[model samples]
Target: MLKSRPNAGRSQPKQQQQQQQQQNRQPQQQQQQQLVHTTSSHYGLEEFFDSSRNLGERQVKSGRAWRTDELRLKSNSDLHKLWFVLYKERNMLYTMKEAAATEYELFPSPERIDKVEESMANLENVVRERNNAYWQLEVSPCATGERPSIFRRDVFGRHRWHKCSQHIPPYHRNWHFRNTQGPGKTNETDWFFHKYREMKRKHYNYFRSRTARYLRDLFRRFPNADAEYIAELHPEFPQGYVQHLKENHVLYDDPPRAATRARIRPSEDVQQ
Candidate 1:
């Protein structure tokens, strides 16, 4: 028991120990570098900065938007990844646009934002389609978890589709405690509705009068214009209104030189 084993406390060689330390350090250093790279890559301000060519350019040509059909063909996972990509792109573009505006420089290829938006919308639609399909196959139709909406009249009597959310049952006395508690009609609301109706009526009358005046002016300016063509063009105008304009506004005169020349020149050329 008192005698120690010969190799029990033997230390590694300096060369071997140093080599081992170097190997361990390599991986740790590599990991640190990778982490730094990842962190820098995700910086929002860096992403928002424009490329050299686009920084001060007036007009930059870009490609079209991602089509719905193209997005539909992608897998859910792929679309999920692409959604974040587009979202980041949109944020970057918005930031760049704001910067450019502040600097009084043109934001080149502004339509890129629109393209990214279109792609994101298509992606969302594809995801929604998949969700609907999954719900139909695995869950009850009513269990899709989307908010149900119904056309309901508000306090002002305006009908709109109100999105319904889970709430306390109607029988609960405190259920109507919310600031937006509904179905309460007041005199103020009635008066507001009355004014809204009156404003709408005025707009309707003004639009009708404008249309009549335009028709009268057109008839006066081009007396020989085809009544049937005019009626076809303005199907919204009553036949009686068209006839009234023709009889009252139009002056019977020879056709304008421009119209006569256009008609006569073609026919003479044909005869020749």
Candidate 2:
């Protein structure tokens, strides 16, 4: 009879059991559903619709990147929220820059805040895309449009531009005109033309004088050396001048030696 008595407080009451079941089921239901935007703070797009909404002014106050392992532990919903946070930060920074420029004041921390926000956005996008692709077995979506290019007309039919990594549409109305003043002046043909000719003339004269001096010195160095063989080695070289060196014994003598520089030799001595 004692054993048959119901064990006191062995199980929760029916009402309590129901409440616990509801709590567990609620989290499961949330996990099963896709997240939706509760606020359009990312692009500052929601500002136009609601005047009472307070968009925070731009401010830079943060430190360090979240560790990859920490980010990996976050749920998809949390990652989405972080993405919007960074997007909002970028919009705020842009707003501050425009306002500062309009007021002729320095944009405090200007590009720094924007760069930080952009880095976070990029990292988040990469992580999200990787997760999405892994889960769905599909490529991440990217913007599509006309390729980037410089517009220039050639002598032919109509044309469009293309570039290696362009993605924006080419609005012909907004095309930036390059070389508006047309072809530049040709100093290359006229100024450099005469300048280069003068340089070449000077160089030719210098080399010619140097070659003649070398031949004369060669004969003087070896007085009894064969002049014919010397002329044969330097066919374009002046031979008559070297003959004068041999006859004068200019550099051929040693020690108390020839004291004067030799003049340019006649061209007749040079072999054809």
Candidate 3:
């Protein structure tokens, strides 16, 4: 009687196991599909494309730049998100602009890129303001976390603000450092400085002389013109110099009366 059901239990169990394996794989397949869809939506190729508009379209009007006041009102996280949005927008615009240039076509709404840049600048300024205020309150009044700059003279003896960095000081014995520190107080440098000063002085004198001559001619042409207006317009001409020109310049002279009209004499024949 037991021999009749020899393969029945094994066959039923194998079929059940197969069904269970398929059921387990179904959820995983659905999960994988869902993940792929989410990823595609988040980072799609569509981002590189501009908004739906014809290639020949031009002059698309847009809103003004984001103001610092408006940006300051937003939370840091929101600002961060906005920055990335604007950054992506700028990159897209640049791409579109280059494409238009290559195609010999006009780029629509180029100012939109400028607006984006200005908004980004405003956002950064607001963030920097907050950072500075926080540093002042929690740390020290003068302590901004930014790098400090030192006033240093270049080879030309021009003063410039150089950012301090992690490097050997100018006084160090390093040859590279000494060479880059500029020609300090040598006879050659002193002579060069003297020559530079002399050149600047000559330029100033030449400019002053040219300006004086121009003022002299202007006053001569417009003797009745407002002296105060002239002075205001050309402060480079000193008040005393302008007054002297007004008083002493010959061009300021009034024109002499036209010679009296020649007396008309009637012909002798007409008298007869």
TM-scores, all models, native as reference:
0.62, 0.29, 0.55
User: Counting only residues 3 or more apart in sequence or on different chains, how many pairs clash (N, Cα, C under 3 Å) in candidate 1?
Assistant: 0
Pairs that collide, model 3: none
Q: Record all residue pairs in model 1 with backbone atoms less than 3 Å apart, i.e. clashing.
A: none
Q: Which stretches of candidate 1 lie over 4 Å from their true place?
A: 1-40, 49-53, 59-63, 98-103, 135-146, 155-157, 171-178, 224-272
Q: Per-prediction count of colliding residue pairs?
A: 0, 4, 0
lDDT of 3 by residue, 141-222 (tens): 9978677888877666656787766765445556676567654567777788789889988998999887767777777878
Give lDDT tens digits, candidate 2, residues 224-258.
88877766766665657556656775644445435
Could you tell which candidate, 1 or 3, scores higher by lDDT?
A: 3
**Cα RMSD, each candidate:** 12.5, 20.8, 11.5
In terms of lDDT, model 3 sits at 0.81
lDDT of each structure? Answer: 0.76, 0.58, 0.81
Candidate 1 versus the native: TM-score? 0.62
Task: Order the numbered candidates by lDDT, best leading.
Answer: 3, 1, 2
- lDDT, model 1: 0.76
